[model samples]
Target chain A: MSLTAANIAAKPKPAATEGNGCQRFNTMPGNGAQPKTNYCASCAAHDKALCSRLTGSDLAEFGSMSQHKTITAGQMLFSEYDDARYYYTVISGDVRLSRMLDDGRRQITGFKSTGDFIGLGTDGHFTADAEAINEVVVCQFTVPTLNQSLEEYSVVQGRLMEMMQEEVINLQNHMLLLGRKTPMEKIANFLVERAKKYSGVDLDGDAITEVDVKLPMSRTDVADFLGLTIETVSRTITKLRKNGVIALETAQHIVIKDIEELELIANGEA
Target chain B: MSLTAANIAAKPKPAATEGNGCQRFNTMPGNGAQPKTNYCASCAAHDKALCSRLTGSDLAEFGSMSQHKTITAGQMLFSEYDDARYYYTVISGDVRLSRMLDDGRRQITGFKSTGDFIGLGTDGHFTADAEAINEVVVCQFTVPTLNQSLEEYSVVQGRLMEMMQEEVINLQNHMLLLGRKTPMEKIANFLVERAKKYSGVDLDGDAITEVDVKLPMSRTDVADFLGLTIETVSRTITKLRKNGVIALETAQHIVIKDIEELELIANGEA
Candidate 1:
C-alpha cells in the first residue's frame, strides 16, 4: 500500500489529539461562520487560512497587520538564506519552493497555491527559495506581527498548529514518492494530485471519468519535484497519453480521461 | 547551500516568531529549572519532550496520564492503518518509521530516538508503521488525554507547534537528499547526521577529527532509508573506508577519521 498524497491528506477523523481532526492542507474550510473584516471580506484565502479563525475586533486587528503583496511570474518571494522577515498565505497563483546545490542542481520541495502558507524557515532565514510560477498575490505578515497574533488568539494558534501538522504529513508522503516511486508512477501521481486540486471534484468514488487539470508550472519544475529528468517526465507523460489514460490539451493543460486507470498507475497497481 | 537536517535544526536564533528558535529534535535542554514529580524526575525524555512545559501540579497531572512502556527489538509500536489511539515520546532506544508498497518496496521515512515523538497520523489512523530498532522504552499518552493536556496548556501547544515546524524543515531537507543527492552523497549525509546525533560532540568548526558512530539499523534499513540498493550502500561504505575517510569497527560501528572530508562529500563538494 503506497502512501500517495491523495490518501494521506484525504483521511478524515472526527477529532485529532492536538486540534480538529487531521486537516488536509489547502483543503479545510473555515470552522464556523465568523465576521470578516472589510479588508479580508473579499480575500479568497481569508476563509481557508489561519486568519479565518479571527472575527470582530480580533479579525480587524490581525487584518491590519497584513499587507497584500503581488509577485510577478518568475520572481522570488524569498530566496534561500534570506532573512525570513515575512510569512505568507497565497491569495492566488502558484509558488514553487526549491533548494539548489552549489553546482546548480535543484530540487523543488513543494508547490504552493491558493490558500497555501509559505516562508517557513529556521534561524530567521528561509530554508528554501519560493518563486512565483505565475503572477501571484499573497497576504504577508511580518514575523513579529504574526507571532503577536498567535499569542493573543488561541483560535489562530490552534489553527496554525493544525496546519503545521498537516504540512508535516504532506511532506512525509512526498518523501515516499521521491525515494521509492518509479518515473511513470511519479508522473501518474503528480497528475492525480493535479486532478484533485484543480478539478474541483469530490473524487471520493472516482465517478468522474474526465477532468481538466492545469499545470501552472513547467516540465522542469515537475521533473525536479518528482526526482526525474525532464526527458523521463516527458516520455512518461507521452506513455500515459498513448495508453489513453490522459490527453494533453496544451503544454500547460491536461485532460484526465480515465482517472481510475491513472490512479492504478499512480499506485503501481497497473 | 544544501539544507541538511543538522543546519536546519542547528541554526540558533534568539527570540523566534514561534515558541523558541527552531529547536532541534532530540536536542535542546528544557527551558528552565522546574519542579519535577517523582515519576518524571528519573525519566530521560522528561525535560526534552512536550511534558517539559509542565511543572509542579501540571507536571504531576500530566505525568499521571503517561504509561511507560517497553517494546522489544523487531516489534511494531504501531502499523499502517492502525488506529492511532496513543502518541509516544521515546525515552530510550530507536524506532524506525516506514511505509511499504504492496510488492514489498519500503521507504524508511524517519528514525525516532530519545526525545523524538511518534504516532502522528491522518484520520485517526497511522500513515506509517513504527517499529522498534532495538529494545525501546517510550512514554505513551492516549489521544484524549494528550488532547486535554494540549487544550489546558498553552505552553504545550506552543512547543508542539515548534516541534512540528522543525519536523517540516527536517523533512524538506531529506526530500532534497532523496530526490537529488548522489548515492555517495546520501550515505555521507546520513553519516554526518549520525555523527551529530550520536557522537556527543559539537560539530561546529570541524573541531573533532575522530568520532565513533553507531548504526542501530541494519544494511537493509540503510538501503531503504537512502533509496539505494543494498549493494550500493555496502560499496559506498567500503569506498569511504578505503579512502581513509572512515573506518569500520564492526557491522554496526564506524569511526570517522576524516570528518571534514565527509562533510565536504556529504554536501557534494568533495
Candidate 2:
C-alpha cells in the first residue's frame, strides 16, 4: 500500500459544506423532463419502497428534479466527498462507482444502470466518485429539495429507509464480492443480478421473460469492480462463452442462452 | 488468491432478503417485560431516523418485537445471504461485521456497538455475518414489521438512506485502505472515526466534545476490518502510541491524543 503525505494529516473539515465540487452533469441540464404520471405503472418492483406512495405533485417533484444528461465514456460525474450537490437516477446507460487510492490505483465499486440511484448520502455530502462506464444518461436532482420533501413526507422517508436498508445489504454484497469470491464467482454474481434486474419486457404488467441485458461496461471496468485484473475478467468471460451457457454479441451485449445453466453457474452448481 | 470450486455459486442474490439461518434467540423468557412504549423512550440514539419515528404503538411494537439474545465471542449472529428474520439494535457489547471466503479466510467489514442496528435489509435480507466480537446483547425484530414501519415513516427512510450511504462510502473508504493507504494510514482512519462516533457523551444534539469510544472489538478484528494482518494493526497502533498520537488505556480502550494528526493519517498525509 502506498502511503502519501496526504495520508499524513487529515484535511481540515470544511466549516460549511461548499458547492464547489458540483460540476456539469454529462446530459440535458436542469430538472427538465416530466416523467410518466405513474413510474410504476408497468413494473412490480416499483412499489417495494421508492416512489411507492407518490402519484401526484410529490411524485412530480421527485420526477421533475431529474435532469437527464448524457456523458461520454471516461467523463467523471463527480468525485468523492464533493459538495453533495446532487443525487442521480440512472435514466439510461451504465455509470461506474469507484474510489481512487492516493497512488492513483482505482477500485470500481459498482456499475449502475437504469433505475439505480447514485450519490446517496447524509450531511449533504458525497464520499466517492461516479463516472460513466459508457455513453450514459442520468437524471440529477439537488438534495436540498429532496431533503425537504423527506421531512414533509413520511412515505418518502419510508422509501428512503427501505433504500438504505437495501444499501447496507448492498455493501455487504460488495463485501461478499471483494472479501470472499474469486473473479469467476464475482462475474457470475454480477451477470446473474443483471439478468434478473434487466430481464424481460412488461406485457400488460405480466412481465415478459425476455432476457437481454446489454453490458455497457468493459472487461477492465468489470475487473476493477470485481477486484481482479482485466486479464482475469477476459479469461472468465471467455470460459463462460466456451461453455455454451451464454452467447456474446460483443464485449457489451450479452444473451444468456440457457437460463438454467446460467443459473447453475450463478449458483455454483456447475 | 485461492481459486476453488466450493463457491462457484454462492448466495446468488442479496442474502439478507432471505428468511433463514438465524440461531433462534431468547433469554430471560419469564421477564415477559411489557414492550417499551411505541415511542422507544429508553432506546439510545433517539432522534436518529430509526429511533425517532418509532413512536407509541410503533415504538412499542418495534421494541417489543425484540427477542433478546446473547452471543459469545466468535459465534456468528448471521451470515451472508441468510434470510433476515430480525433487524437488531445492539443493546450492549460489540458486534463485528465480516465476510468469509469459501476458502475460510475472512475480511472484517464493519464494527457495531450499542445503539447501532445490524442486519438491516430491504430487497427481501442479512448480506454479511454479524458476530460477537465481545459478549453482546441484541434486540432482534422481525423483518416484516420493520419493512412495514419503513413504508410508514420518512424519517426512518432518511435514516436508513443515510446509513446505506454511509455503508457504501465506508466500503469505499476500506477499499482505499486496502488498495492505496498504508498500514499507518488505515489505523489512523480507524482512530479518527472511532473517536468521532463513540468517544463522547450526548451533549446537546451532537455527541459530547470529550467522550471515549471504547473498542470492545479486538486488535485482531480491527486488523481484519482494515484489511491488514494482526501484526500490521499491532505495529501501527504501537507506533501511534509511541508517537503520542493515541493512548491505550487497555487493550481495547483508546484515547486520541491528537485528533488532527490522526486525521492527517486518515487523509494520507505523511
Candidate 3:
C-alpha cells in the first residue's frame, strides 16, 4: 500500500495544523481566536456549494468550523479505509477518487472538481482513496460539525440531500458508461462532461461551436476511469483528432472543434 | 420501447386504483377514509426500511399516504424519462433497474429487493427503467407526500440519508468490479453479493460453509449487470462448478459449497 502523510494519522486533526511539508492555511475565522473574515462571501465556490443555502449568521457559523487546506499535486488527501472524519468541498483544482483490488489493479471511480462535495455519503470510514490530481484547495469540515449544522439548518440539510441525489444520478450514468459504452463513445462522453463542467458549455443550452478543455489527470488515469487500456485511450483520441472533431493543444489540453459532432459520438448517434 | 400499463400514464396517480390488471391494494389506512390498522407493525420490511425510524401516530400518518402495488413478472414499474411520481420500498421479490444506449445496448445498474428504496435519488424524471424480475410487491408513496413526511420527521430524513450512503458505497464497489476485475472475479463477486443479500450469510460474521442463493434475474440480466457476455457468464459459472466452489441446483438456483474459496476469487486473492 502506498501510504501518505495524511493517511498516517488515525485521529481527526486539522490538516492545516499538521506540518506535512505542504501548503496549508488556518482559514477558520469568527471562532473568537481568529480574526473574523467573511470568508464565505468571497469564496469562488460559495454560490455553488451547499453553504449557499445558508445566509448571514448560519453561513458564518458553518464557515467558522471549516478550515482551508491545500493538497499538493499527486499527494493523497486520504486513502481507502482512512478515518473519514472530515468532509470537503473542492475550492480549486481536481481530486481523483479510486479503489484498488488485492492484486493492485486500480479503478478510478470519479473525479471531483471545484464546487464538488466529498465525503457526504461516507459512513465512519472512507471507502476510496482520494488523491489530488493537481494542486487542490478544499474547505474542510469535521463530521460532527457538519452534522450539527445539518441538524440546526434544514435548508442546508435539504441542499445536502439534493447534492447527494445528483451524485447518485451521476454515478448511475457513469455506471452505464463503464459497463456498456464503446471506447470512442467513452472518450467523447468524457470530453463532453469536462467541457460542460470546466467551460460551462451546456449541451441543452445555447449552441457553442468550440471550447478549450483541460485534462489534468494523466492518460493512465483516464484509461482507468473509462475501463480501457491507455493505448486504447490514446489511439481513440488520435482518431478523434484525425476526424477533425477535436484538436490537441497538448497531452493535457484539447480544443473541441465540433461540440455537436462530439456530442453525437458521445450519445452513440454519430 | 416496451411500455407497460404502468408507464402509459404521465401523472402521479395511485397505482392501486388504476385498474391495470395487476394485483393492487389500497392499504393506506388511518386517513379517515380507510380502516385504522397498524399495517406497518406487521410489514416484513418495516424494521429494515426507512420508516423504521417512525412510531405510533408518526408511522400511522406516514403509512396512511403509502399504497401497496404488485407488479407481475416482466412488467415495468417505470421507464426512463417517465415523470417521477412514486417512490417505492420493495416488500417482496426483485426489481431490476437499467439504462439503455441509443443503439439499444442496455446496462443493468442494480437489483432492488426487500427493504430496498427504488426512487430516492431521482430528479423530476426517472433516469432508468425499473422492471419486475418476478411478481413484486412494493409500498408506494407520492413524491410530495414523502417530502412532507421528510420535513416533518427528522429521523426519517436521517434514515434516508444513511440508505443513500449505503447505495453510493455499493455502487462504488460495483464500479471497481466492472472496470478492473476479470470475468471470473466479476461472477464470483456477484454471487457473493447475492449470497449475502438473499441468504444473509455475512462474510465477516460466522463460518457458514454453505448457502443457497437464488438467481431471480435472467442470465442476460446478470451478464448486463456484470459487464460480461452471457456466454462468458455461463462459462464462468461452469468453471466454478467444476472447481467445487459452487453447484448449480438448477438454472435459477445456486448452492455455494465453498464460500471462502469463492470470496477469495471475488477479491482476486486466489
Q: In lDDT terms, how accurate is model 1?
A: 0.76
TM-score versus the correct structure, for each prediction: 0.85, 0.68, 0.89
Question: Compared with the true structure, what per-residue lDDT tens digits does model 2 show for residues A112-184?
Answer: 7766767553344455678877777665666666666566665655555555555555666666556545566
Work out candidate 1's RMSD over C-alphas: 11.5
Residues A158-268 of candidate 3: C-alpha lDDT, one tens digit per residue: 777777777787888889988998999999999999998788666556667799999999999999999999999999999999999999999899999999999999989
Among all candidates shown, the one with the greatest DockQ: 3
lDDT for position A201 in model 1: 86
**Interface RMSD of each candidate, angstroms, one decimal:** 9.9, 11.4, 9.1
Among the numbered candidates, top lDDT falls to 3
Q: What are the per-residue Cα lDDT tens digits for candidate 1 across A59-170? A: 7778777777777899878777665677889989999999887888899999998888885434456678889999988878778778777777767766665566566667
TM-score of 2: 0.68
DockQ of predicted candidate 1: 0.23
Scored against the true structure, residue A228 in model 2 reaches a CA lDDT of: 76
What would the per-residue lDDT of candidate 2 be over residues B165-235, giving only the tens digit for each residue?
Answer: 55555666666565446788878888777876776643234333333557777777887777677888898
- Tell me how each candidate scores on DockQ against the true complex: 0.23, 0.21, 0.40
Residue-wise C-alpha lDDT for candidate 1, range B21-131, written one tens digit per residue: 122232324544544364575567877677776777777777877777778899888777665577889989999999887778889999999888885434456678889
Model 3 has a DockQ score of 0.40
Q: Which stretches of candidate 1 lie over 4 Å from their true place?
A: A1-36, B1-36
